[model samples]
Target: MQNHTIYIRTLKRAEHTVFCVEDGQKTYYDPQFKRMLPYASGQQVKRSLLDSFCDAGNIKISPTTFYWDFNKKKELKEGEAFGTCDPTYPDQLIGGWMKASKGGGSRTLKRRSPLSVSAMKPLHPLLAGVNKDSASFDRSGHSHNKIIVRGEDGKELNEDEINTILEGKDRSLTRKWIPASNKATGLFIQDIAIDLRRLFSIRLDDFEPEISQEVEEKLRESGWVEGENVFGRCLIAPVKLREKLIPILAYAIINWKITSNQARTFSLMETLAVSIGGNANKIAGAIRAKLSEENSEQAIPVVEEQVKGIDTFVTPTAAGYVATTTESIEAMDDAEEKLIEILSSYAYEALPEFAL
Candidate 1:
C-alpha cells in the first residue's frame, strides 16, 4: 500500500469573497498566532473536486447521484422511482457514502473516505492580507408606473390630461429612499475578504486499503477482479484509484470556482506545485526557504520564477528517494486525457451496452 501526499500552492486570481462571519468579522483569527488568516475549509475544496468530476462527461452516472446525497426512501416519498445504491459506483467507492436508516433506526451504513483534504491556508503569515472595508450601495430609486387612462369616448388620454383627470387619485410616479441617519450617502455594510494574489497551501492525502475485504468480495461477485479491469483494480487496490483521481483533482484545483454568497464570478487560483508521494512539510519547507532567501518585499514573483524552472526533483530521506514533480498545464492535461482513456476502456469493457 502506498501513501501519497500532494502539495499545491494557490494564487487568488479573482476576488476571494468571504462567507464565514462571526460577530461582524469575516476573517478567522488564530489565537496561537494572534493574527487573522485567510482560509478555505477542506469541505469547500472537496466539494469543488466532486463538482468538477460531476461536470465532466467522462463519467456515466447521473450528476444527482454522483455528488448529492441520495436516499431511496426519501425519493419514494415524493412518488419518484429510484434505484438502490450501487456499491461499485466510482464516486461511492472512492469518495464514500452513507446509507441512513429508515425512520431514524440505528442501522446506518457508512463508507469511510480514503481521500483526505486539508484546508487551504496561507503558506506564510506575511503572505496573507485581509481587506477590512465595507461596501456601500444606493438602494434609493424612482420609477414611473404609467397608468393607461381612457376617456368616456374610448380614446386614450395624454399624460397631462390623465394627471388632470386623476387629480385626487394616486399619481403614477413613485419615489423610494431610505431615511438618512444624519448622512446623505447610502447605507454601508462591512465585510472582510482575503486580498488577491495571496499564496495558500492545500494538501491531499490518499490512504490504501480503503474498503473492507468483505466489500471487495461483494464487488468481485459483481464481475470485479483485481488487476483485470480499471474499476475492479481501483476497487481492490486504492493506488490505481489515486493515480486516476489525482490528475483530475489537479485540474480541479487549477480551475476551482469557489461558490460564495458574495457576488464573485470567477476563481483566480493558480497551481504552483503538486508533489505526490512526498512529505508536504518538506515541500513547504523548500518553498519557505526560497521565499526567505530573498529579502525583497516582492517575493512571490521571484519564487514563482524559481518554481517554474523546476520540473522534477528528488528528496533523499530515511525512507528513500521520493519523486516530486511540479506539473505544468500541458502535463496535467495529458494526464487527464490518459485518465479519460482509462475510464473509457473500463466503461467499454464493464458496461458494453452503455459503451459509446
Candidate 2:
C-alpha cells in the first residue's frame, strides 16, 4: 500500500499522529483542535479494521466515520480509527489497494477511467462559493463541509459567527456558498419562475371546484378561506395545514422526549426533513417542547409512535396535511441514482482506455 504522511497541526498546539495506517479514504479530525489531516483511505483502512468484509454487487457506498477521540483536556496520539460504508447499504466493497509497495485498491470499483479531463460548467453566472443546504450543523443527512472551530473546551462559536467567517461581507447569505459550513449554497437559486410555474401548474383530474361544493364547505369551516367569491361562493381553501403542519409535527418529533420508552434518539431527523421546513421546525419544536412538558403520558407515547412509523427512505407522514403540490420526493433520489449511472456508464464509456 502506498503510504503518505499528511501534516496535521493544532493551529495553536503541537502536532501528533492520529493513526498509523489502514485502508480507504480516511481523514483524522480532532474536533478539539479544529484540524483534519489525511490519515488513510481506500483498502488500507478497510482491511486493517474490518474482517470478513466484502463488496458484493457494489451495494455499499462506503462513507464511514474516520473515527478519533479526545479528552476534555488531553491530546490524541497514535490511535485506532476506521469507517464503514453507508450503513443502509448492504454488501461492502474490498476498498483500498492490495499491494504493499505498489498500486492497487478497490478491485471491485472500476478505477475512474477518465476518458478525458473535463470541467463541468455551471448553468448560471459561474460564481464560486461554499454550499449550505442542510437543516443542522452537518450532524447527519448529507455529508457537507464543516469548519470545526475549537473553543477553550472545544465548543464552537455560534452559527452566526461561523457563518460570518464563511460569508465574509456578503449579506446575501441565502445565495452565498458557505465553504466552512460544507453546504452547497452556491448552486444557483434558479429563477423563481421555475417554482412559480410548478406552483400554478394544472394536472389532469386533480381538483375541480365546480364539481365539489361540499368539499369547499368543509374547508370553509376549517378556517381555510377568508376571501369573497364573485358568485358569493366563498367555498375557498382548506386550512392550509400542509404548508406548516408537517414541519411543526416534525419539530414535535425531534424535541418531543419519549422518556417512557427511553428512546432518546430516532430517525425523524431525516425522514421528516422532507416536509418540514426550517422555520416550521423551529416553531413546531418550541410548541412541542411546551406541550411535551405539560403532559407526561400523552407526549411520550405519541412521540414514540410517530418516530416508529417513520421511513427515512420514503416520504414521511404527518397528521394534519390535506393538500400537497409536489411529486413523490422519491423523484429526487431517483434522479441522483440516474445521474450516477449516467456518469459511470455513458459519460465514461467513450473515454480512451487507461494505463495498466
User: What is candidate 2's CA lDDT for residue 278?
Assistant: 16
lDDT tens per residue, model 1, 65-184: 222344765542332222223445554443555555446443344444445555665554445545544344433353435456678999988989977876897643343343321101
Among residues 3 or more apart in sequence or in different chains, the pairs in candidate 1 whose N, CA or C atoms overlap within 3 Å are 13-268, 14-268
| Per-model TM-score on C-alpha atoms | 0.49, 0.18
lDDT of 2 by residue, 144-245 (tens): 645455567878788877776777564432333433222111111100000111111111122222212343344456554333322222222232432322
TM-score of 1: 0.49
Q: What TM-score number comes out for model 2?
A: 0.18
